[model samples]
Target: MLRILFCLLLAAPALAAPPAEGPSPLWGMLQVIFGLLLVLAAIVGIAWLFRRFSMGSMLGRFQPARVVSGVMVGPHERVVIVELAEEWLVLGVTSRNVNLLKTMPKPAGHDAGQPAANPPFAQWLAAAMDKARKRQGDGDK
Candidate 1:
């Protein structure tokens, strides 16, 4: 019984070697971090490209640029618009009572301070109504 107990104790130590395959925990975590960083860089690059293109267009047309103003925003929504060149760009707007009007595709010499054709509330309501009507029609069909 004494000899058997000694043998069991010796065998336990043989099974204590650390794993020696694949990446360590630290390496795995580093890889995940690097991947995230790469993704972020790509997003930034794409955004830069878009900005450059938009700016180029504005410069090409030599249009006077203006900023959007007096807009309101809501908690559950955001608005984004890129006008010709850089005439008026309203990004992440959350106004419940805002309207968007059409502008000349080409650059205009003057600031055409026209209201947007569709207001935020009207657009949202119209979209919702259209969706509801479509759903009702589908049900009937």
Candidate 2:
């Protein structure tokens, strides 16, 4: 019985599961931080590319040339009238390009002092809704 007890004690140590070997907590944290840094770098790279590609249009907005008005012609195209010291340029703006469609002398009536270039969207929407309601009322009558 003494011999059997000693054997069982020795076997017990061998039978128990070995401690799980895994990356240390510090190493795991470092990997997470590195992954975060990679994502941050990618974001910054994309922003830089966007800014570089769009610099042409942005330059006019910042420089002596001022954007008088702009309207969207399509999902990815726009018509913009830019004002300079002497002349106004009509520009056709696309996703990756800007073209001068026309250039004309600044109109005598159009100057620095002007009301809001466009009416508030909310007011426009309200006006349309009223028109619709009037039409519906007329139809019912």
Using lDDT as the measure, which candidate wins? 2
Instruction: Tally clashes: model 1.
Output: 10
Best by TM-score: 2
Please report, in order, the local distance difference test score of every candidate based on alpha carbons: 0.64, 0.80
Against the true structure, candidate 2 has what lDDT? 0.80
lDDT of 1: 0.64
Model 1 misplacement above 4 A: 1-20, 62-141
- Candidate 1 clashes between residue pairs 3 or more apart in a chain or in different chains: 72-94, 72-95, 73-94, 73-95, 74-94, 99-119, 100-116, 100-117, 101-116, 101-117
TM-score of 2: 0.38
The C-alpha TM-scores of every prediction are 0.32, 0.38
lDDT of 1 by residue, 10-97 (tens): 9987878876798889999999999999999999999999999999897768545444333333565555454646455544444355
